[model samples]
Target: MTSITRLFDFPYYQQDKYISIPDALVTKQNGVWVKTSTEEYISKANAVSRALLRMGVKKDDKIAIISTNNRTEWNIMDIGVLQTGSQTIPIYPTISEDDYEYILNHSGAIYCFVSDIEVLRKINLIRNKIPNVLEVYSFNAIEGCKNWVELLKIGEDETNQYLVEEQKNKVQTEDLATIIYTSGTTGKPKGVMLSHRNIVSNVLNSAPRIPFEAGKSRALSFLPICHIFERMILYLYQYYGVSVYFGESIDKISDNIKEVKPTVITAVPRLLEKVYDKIYAKGTELTGIKKKLFFWAIDLGLRYEPYGANGVWYELQLKLARKLIFSKWKEGLGGNLDLMVSGSAALQTRLARVFAAAEIPVMEGYGLTETSPVISVNDMRNKGFKVGTVGKVIDGVSVKIAEDGEILCKGPNIMMGYYKDEKLTSEVIIDDYFHTGDIGEIDAEGFLRITDRKKEMFKTSGGKYIAPQLIENTMKQSRFIEQIMVIGDGQKMPAAFIQPNFDFVKEWAKIHKIEIGTTNEEITADPKVIARIQEEINRLNDKFGNWEKIKRFELTADIWSIEGGHLTPTLKLKRKIVMEKYIDLFHKIYN
Candidate 1:
């Protein structure tokens, strides 16, 4: 695949003859998705840029966007910001108020964009703290603020057109494009400065790996656009002319998947886990021969290797398994899903193999916000793609394991540095290689396998090092376990604080005629429930050595989530916050 000939120029991508811009970019209108054609998209974006110029916005100014995936407006704002040689500072709509206040103040944003009236109210409440913000515009109409579309009318003023055109011509590959504040599972969010070169290089090189046939490939965008992984892919969609559909909301993905019938989609492991969990839960409801077949198909899936050759009989069994069982799984994912890319965290090897066996190719990749988010991805082509590894490093990127086993990468995709934090930047990027805190290994064929976070490994009282992530992942395989956090620092044995799959257990309690209380606390305290969880732990304990095995656990029906501060927006565990909140639970396990 050739590099984008125009290099770091984003606006120029609109002009590519090979890349067919659709008749309409989709957006919700009157409770139904509507399209605004390619010409309209360009005209609207250009008009918005002119409006910014009319508002006295200057080059290099920071414009903050506080919105969910309003695909049409978000892209228009992004291109508008680009045309003016200004930079966008995107804040996750779900972040804490204090965090939002910190980002606004720190970024020195002069103009802000919000998704709706509720978001506008949030900005209005925090307006005093962020004194530099001169104006707030709402994508949805609000009583107090300017509407985003009104800005387009400002661009129509003949006086502003010349300046917008002049500013658009000034955008260069080396110019600062955006400042992304990572939603770290721990500590304060740092702004990662990405230039046009950093993101464009990633998109152009990474786009080809994705099987996109112009006019045929459609993508359902659900991941937070604020995240680099989704944003980079958004650009790839633009470059390759893939029709994109914005999910209504996280809860509506099921309906949207069916409506869009996307050939390709991107997701985090948690979403895929939910899909698996739902299917597993349904399968558990079957009985006799049907129940046996369900589990049998699942077991075969876990053993199915795409690259390795199983015997003729095994292959035949797999074929039967796909027809009888796996076909239903595909239909659930909208019947057109050819590729589902999972990233932001390590996908469980079991899930990866099972999905591949079902003929739903899940390409698990690895990277962080700092690496423009894709260091490596499993190729859907199945040529040499490994299930457990994060595939071979992408073209033009060099990855190696440090002596300490941390994955270090150097490439055009690497961010310039931490915005306005040189000392912190120097700590991570040494001799041009960005030190990824993940501990991983490169196999002989060049696939990368991430084991655990370098800082997350803890030692037991017996002086044996244990990776909690490994234990947590293994334990979560149980249908009863929704989330688990392993705990044991200088202790006799490792214990876990677990969030139970309450709905699943509720059904089990009824079937067994085990009376339990209504609330989470009461349900978790039931003796029968405890016994059932113990059985699961005992089964999983076979996979680990005695030192690494979880000796005990405290179950809770309390779900961990991003809003609860127990999870990052990307769904990685916020271990520190979770530990602080559940000290008593941990004590119960250890005691």
Candidate 2:
């Protein structure tokens, strides 16, 4: 039996030692669900390796993959590149062309594979700028562009299978597997160099935490495969013989979930927030008894305690709530979503409680791309689950809170270092512990609770330190605020630039018979809307210390998005970019 030490060994191990499912990987194409059996997946990946070898791909060669959505092709290509002892550079498709140029050049990627015409076009715009990128291939066949199928066709001869094997044998568990450029909120994206051991250890260690039913478990993967969180989970799925289905896109996830009926999925907090908001909006449209029951269930869910800590009467009420209201919530999310792993940012505790109460457990985890992503995750078994914390540190990983409160981690999962940036890497990884730059604490029970980003906490002019993330998370519980950034560094008081939840605000306007205008600018400018948002802030402010309360706020007319240069691809706010974009509003709040 092949040991799962290297990233490329996962599929082979699954096929030889585990159940080989006919639907190991499924992707929607032209409105039809296409299945790739474990046999076909391995065969195709082998062919990709042979083709790359034939094309002169050598050890340490870098290959860039830029995809608009998660697909089987990306996964196959990933394994293929790894088998050749080459590094896979996964780039986010939503980033600016300048970023595309920077990553390709910085990694010296010899060849680039794109998922669609749009990504190809972006590459075409800067083809000349990145001199090291030898060629560009598209997963989707495009006129005048090289297609990935051409490589598969070249490898169909199978004459060079021995060469593929030779290279695969040369690959080591500690060898660099991928260079994932972090879509950071500020500055250039850092290429996080992760080894096969870094990720394989994470998958193996994190697997026991997730209750997978082996071959019977199904997962709908919609998160970006470029990110280690999703990419590592894909390997874990393969390792556990879980059938993986790729959602068509973010907009079509609802429909795809119903079609796939996956037993589990991974998501970011922002996506979960949107899902909850959509469901809550629908509940508000209910009438009389149904409406009361819906809100009652929501309130009950917000107060949920795991392990029946709320006692037998509360458990009985929760049972009734699940049947009467929360059951529909489960059904709406495919009726089979038993677990969801939330990461990449802080998840609202209310959101976590409500979803778990609905019987769809969302296990929030914490890690950076450099750590192969999973350091700790909330697990349900053996009192391992916690309501607000990120759960206990995974097996084989050690975490300690620094005197300054930054979470320091040392584990097999930690990256080798940032690519070609030894000076920068030295500053973060000290005494074998990676300074996570996240302020957090381990409770007496061993649950890790993240408080804020080390650099994001700011001091008011009066010398009081304010952790904006805690305040922001609390404020976002309101249905009115969609996005917010608290800005008050070196200022007299803390203030915020808020992007209202337009959909919910419109619904609220209808309920109140208020005549707020149609456009975002007009709605933000309306005194009634401003006053109502202020009321929400005032109510939630009591949760914080006097120095940390939001003293003033200004609403933004436009939504903050990745394309708008206000958020990273991971959906974290680009604080510098956001502040620059909302300078006028910032001045209005402080002045």
Candidate 3:
């Protein structure tokens, strides 16, 4: 830690130090992760830079990537482009056609390093329309595109001294590193222009607060690095020399965890929630006594606090409970997850609490793409790990509540502005303080808790403001409901649009002899199924007033997913899209 005279003087040299970040690479050779030291990384990065120059990449040019978690190729291209004083444009593999087109056109990327031919097919859909794209490079052996191995071979003259000089002099701290487009569920994806300072500043500012150790902590990355939440952490890992293992996919994350045994990783709330559901699913498959104790241990972890009620013996029992029950969860996470930091969305407090009680530190943070994606994070060493709040602002960041209740932030982490969209940029970033759309309040201890989005708040016909997220969080506590969206912008009372946990409902239906071969529409329309869902909704509505209570509800057969057009890449509901698409059903319910 550098000695600073005042507490607020931290993060002063992050941008300066990032220019000095060591060039180290972690490569996968023969299935074993090998650490290529700083010298080797620079050599490889220089080689890649030489390759890009040979490919006619110019200064301030844009390079695009379409892949999941291939850190090898992703980082190489990222650093290689930066070495040429160029920007990298990353597109999420799961982004819709609208966002993909917006990112390509918005980023002004002239060349692309696509992962395979499938992505090329997507590019071919609108390639003629996108005039900026000059060439496309594929990572694997694709028939029509330039291959990765072949591209690297082009710059194979490792003795190219000019490439080395290019790495040293061409890049600067304030140069554009990446032009990230945010997946705005309500509107079009906006390209967030991040400079080397914006991203490196975020890494240096956040890395210390997180529990990380060079050559000690490893991470299994399955989360899409196209977003800043993952990209910032990726840079933080590079800065700290934390080895990263790319999980084959979401399905293989558990198997990879056992193999890599990572000490730290980051995730969104949905992934963690699924893990919790799986544990219970596995528990239900066990024999009588074991199953009973499994559920008992989990129930205890969820309900019990760190401080025991009945003194030493009770505390000892709780310890036994942890060893017997929750230890498997710790093992499931590769037996060494010191902390799992969640961002990009709000984490349910109940889930966060249970994970913390299980001895796995669940540090949830809050930020938007506009702030280089990190404004605040809970520290493992601090007492401010409140379940509801997104911790305090990182050491040097200044945060204040606006009169309208929007969270306003000012720091080095704040972005320069939205690229090419001056009118939209002016609406959010004012006088260097970025107005976060979320409505939040700082506690007496300075921890910030977001109530809901300022724009997400709606009104009933009676004109009483209703925050759907608050009710949705409360309703999600039930095991029966998997996903819920509350609606009542101009209606008499709020009503819920619900999706049930299919596996749970199907099993329950089978046990009750309620034949489950019906389609989603028929299943939701079934009298018995309707009664059960209504029972669950009514149980939740008991806690609310007539204005807030769900007056009518709907259970759809379809799952809300990124591919299904109901969710954003980050798993946030496209409320406007969903409402409009299902408007007829909503209207029929009220009529």
**lDDT per residue, candidate 2, 1-591, as tens digits?**
888899999999889866578999998888798999889999999999999988899999999999999999999999999999999999999999999999999999999999999999999999989999889999988999999999889889898899989999999999999999999989999999999999999999999999999888999999999999999999999998999999999999999999899999999999999899889889888999999999999999999999999999999999999999999998999999999999999999999999999999999999999899999999999999999999999999999999999999999999999999999999999999999999999999999999999999999999999898899889999999999999999999999999999988998999889999999999999999999999999999999889988989999988888899998989998999999998988888778
Q: Across residues 1-591, which tens digit of lDDT does each residue of candidate 1 receive? A: 333432224434544544535633676666788776556777788888888888889999999998865478988898888879899998998888789898998888999999987677677778889999998888877786788888888887767778877886687777788999999878889999988888888887676677778655788888988999988887887676677788888898998888888888899988998889989889989999999999999999999787547788889999999999999888988998878888998788899999999988898888888988888888867574787888888888999899989999999989989988999999999999999999999988888899999889889999998888887888888888889988898898888888988887888888888888778888889888888999999999999999999888888667888889999888989999999999888777677
Per residue, candidate 3 scores C-alpha lDDT tens digits across 475-547 of 8777678888898888887887888877787877886888756577677777787788788888988888777
TM-score of each: 0.96, 0.99, 0.91
- Candidate 2 matches the true fold with a TM-score of 0.99
Better of 1 and 3 by TM-score: 1
Please give the distance, in angstroms, between residue 163's alpha carbon in candidate 3 and its true position after superposition.
4.7
lDDT of 2 at 348: 95
What is every candidate's alpha-carbon RMSD to the true fold?
2.1, 0.9, 4.2
Model 2 global lDDT (CA atoms, 0 to 1): 0.94
Error of 2 at 188 (Å): 0.8
Candidate 1 residue-wise lDDT at 208? 60
Provide the lDDT at 309 for model 1.
Answer: 72
Order of models, best lDDT first = 2, 1, 3
**Each candidate's clash count:** 2, 0, 0
- In candidate 3, stretches whose alpha carbon ends up further than 4 angstroms from where it belongs are 1-40, 304-314, 543-546
Ranking by TM-score: 2, 1, 3
Q: Over all chains combined, what TM-score does candidate 3 have?
A: 0.91
Overall lDDT per candidate, in order of appearance: 0.84, 0.94, 0.76
